[model samples]
Target: MTARRDELAAFLRAARERVRPEDVGLPALGRRRTPGLRRQEVAELAAVSIDWYVRLEQGRVGTPGSAVLDGIAAALLLSPAERVHLHLIARGEAPPQPHVPAPLSGSLRALLNGMPLLPAYVMDFRFDILACNAAASALFGPEFGHGRLSNTARMLFLEPEARETNLDWAAFSREMVGNLRVNQARHPDDPHLAELIAELRAASAEFAAWWDDQHVHERSRGTKRFRHATAGTLTVAYDMLAALDGSDQRLFVLTLADEPSERALRTLVTAHATALANAV
Candidate 1:
């Protein structure tokens, strides 16, 4: 009867309607008037009674326990983010409040500016590049420079140059999409993030496929390789540092993965600095 109940009911039904019987290793028993697995079939897969699932789907039941929700999530093949969302909604907890981005902390800026030798930047939960150092611009190219401040998710999946340069494109692309999925469920009302996600889904087939998989990543650290125009191959290990100020802003710091990469980064930054000074 309540809004939460209604939302939970809709979420469950939609999830159920997206999975085919064969998707869960069941046979295509016959053509039905509707799409997705039947209520009885889902109940079988989730180990719940048909009546119970019907009541839950119709928003006619009280808060179910964790086991029931988990079972239903698995039966529907929900992604990690969707699973968490199901629990929250079915348990009657309010969805997370929309995030209001805060200004970069002094320490985060200092970290970015001080790391002239390393490519560093600050990004919000939406993966929007908020601030970047000269080294980051130099390494990622001018698209990451001022005024552009492109979303990292957009670059890895949308930009042809990024796809060409990033040696671990497939792995990195999945991670970025997964991290964005977490935000998609967490902050459902963010227009900017919603626009970005829709854009990626419409424009990039890889993004569309990865998004449907529903993988969710809260934080990530990994080594990645890039084939730079001048530096041949550059490898870096990066970390996402959570801001200590209780904000969603994260400082991304990249370290050379090897001695050769370190030397190349130094050379790249020096040349970038010189070029900037010369144009002034």
Candidate 2:
């Protein structure tokens, strides 16, 4: 519990440091000793007393009310996901127990196989790639080899190749970090998630910056752009399908919109399939 308190305090401090005084309408009066807004300043902005805020930051109290958490979130300029994480940590429910990895049943694989024109893949709650069709593999890159794969969020933040392939790297990076922020709130204690966060913080400055912002994003249909070395620029629509069972597995499918993009997609799929077939 003390450890959890300390962790929360550190997370709060990191979050605070990223937001400038000017960002929250505070006067940037000359130089400052601290990297971020002072405790009193935060208290003032949050409409709380210096003493109470100090106590919370010091981890003197076990839990804070939602109202108090809300104030702190506002003071820190936390994003929606970050606010949720703050509340979860305050209530000592940030970290969740690890569950067994759900298997990708044959039926699910069959369904993906049937979607010939669409690039499809299955992922666990942690974004671990369970299974992906040839089209999906082609969309990501040829470098993404088979077998036990790393989580998509981890790869996006840490892998140089993924960063290079992303058409709008900054936007995609923020979205990945924001999604991770939400996942952290939902399963804070997952060791895999913790490790991935630590690894990302070490690997990419951009990732570290976004992670500190405390942004959150819900899983939903969206458009993503990729710069395929062979296919040029390709835009695809993505959707997440939740598993019927109680497990947290989700199926992500990507499809092209028009003729040029569709042709590019077909080329990619054909190339990937040929490569895989030759390997087999």
Candidate 3:
């Protein structure tokens, strides 16, 4: 038991050491000989006292409750996998798995593809793009239509072009992170989700920091502006439609709010069709 507690302590220390002050929205102080975040800084962020955190690092504290563990995990900017590991070590039990996204139905695929004018797509709980319409394909471009690039969250953070295409890049990215956090809370044991989170954390410092904020969001509806390469600026309102079929999958439909945006979307769709015809 003591050995296990010691292992936990070491893990905590290592986790803390990997997160820098600026990563969590904290201003970088004077140069320190040590790397990563200081224990006091972590305590302050986690809303725990310096003494408790010190004892935790020293392996002198007992098993922390879920709330305290979650707070610490947030402060240390632990990934989903790391958070699950922390919970297991602290609670000595396996955590419950969140509902995994089921495969897209044929009807759903047909429905999404049928919408030629509107940019429509089906996304799973994790924001993986299962299928997209011609308009969506044209609007998002090739990067989003390919295999691994089909994941919207991954593309938003990892793809450099996404930063340029998204009008309000910072706000949009932060909201996406918040939505992912909501899913992470529900499905802590999901390996793919864990892997996705790890990749995002490694790829984007902004994602790493925003995730630590522990904001939760569910997508009902939102407005977005995009600068399509061929279409110029297009503003669209998106509605997330929940399927009545008991699955967690959602069909997202984007509609142009104004005449100019509608014209832009039409132009993109026409150009896309022309390119496809030329390719064939």
Candidate 4:
């Protein structure tokens, strides 16, 4: 515990030293002995007492709450990843993960549209749909639109239609749960993810049971079966491509592997287009 506190204090000091006063809109005071912002300045930015900040910096303070940590992070101008690390070190627990979606580049959108025959979509770290091509919208239905309804994990677990849409419901649910577990382990402090897991556990008994198994899996590329409302059963091969940007976004493309599946996909896409045109 003492060692942990020492490490936390040192980390806080280093983070404070890296931040400049001008960066946080503070005037540059002439001739400071230290390179970075002073402890008092950091405390003021965080809206905490100087003594309290001093105790925290000297390894005399106990684990702070989320609000205090958040303030410190802001004071230090910590990046998302750094903020998470700070919480872990100080509290020995994961902090809340904010939902800051990275922007989708036009090139990625063009790439998705380029594959007219395939159903492709982009997902953030939380499996939230960021963007999708026309084929994906056709395949997954209109609920696949961006927003709460489009979250892949939420749709799979909470949405009643998923049980009917996924042909192999048991296998598919297990794989999705396992993949989520892997991500949870990778980023335990993410608040949004924790909330998602809690919601799933409360909503689905099957999800709760699967989560208990502590299974971890990373689903990059594989074969998945779906029962389309109009097109019927189809088996497709999928490939998950990682984005070059450091946003932890992945692009998933599903291609029809067989003639029957190809026919179904084409029919689905055509019907979707017709319905959209009629609606417009």
**Highest-TM-score candidate:** 3
Error of 3 at 249 (Å): 1.9
Order of models, best TM-score first = 3, 4, 1, 2
Model 1 residue 39 distance off true place after TM-score fit, in angstroms? 23
Q: How do all models score by TM-score?
A: 0.64, 0.63, 0.68, 0.65
Candidate 1 wrongly placed segments (more than 4 Å): 1-99, 145-149
Judged by whole-model lDDT over C-alpha atoms, candidate 1 comes out at 0.78
Best by lDDT: 4
Off by over 4 Å in 2: 1-97, 142-149, 278-280
lDDT per residue (tens digit) for residues 49-82 in model 3:
7999898777677766565666677677788788
Candidate 4, position 65, lDDT: 68
**lDDT order of candidates, best first?**
4, 3, 1, 2
Please give, for residues 1-280, the per-residue lDDT of candidate 2 as tens digits.
7786887889888888887887765677888777888887776655456898888877887666554566567667777688778867677654334467778888999998888768888887678888877777777665443432457876777667777887777786787687777776766445555445645554467776676667787666778788888898888777889898877788988878668899998987888788888999
In angstroms, what RMSD does candidate 3 have relative to the true structure? 5.1
lDDT of 4 by residue, 1-280 (tens): 8888888888988998888888775778799898899988877666567999999877677777665676677677788788788888888987765657679988888898898878999987778888888898888877685666778888888778887888777887898899888877665555556556655654567886788777887888888788876788899888889898888889999988799999989988898889999999
- How badly does each model clash, as a count of residue pairs? 0, 1, 1, 5
Per-residue lDDT tens digits for candidate 1, residues 46-65, read 65679999998877778776
Cα miss at 153, model 1 (Å)?
Answer: 0.9
Per-model lDDT: 0.78, 0.73, 0.79, 0.80
Q: What is the lDDT of residue 82 in candidate 2?
A: 86
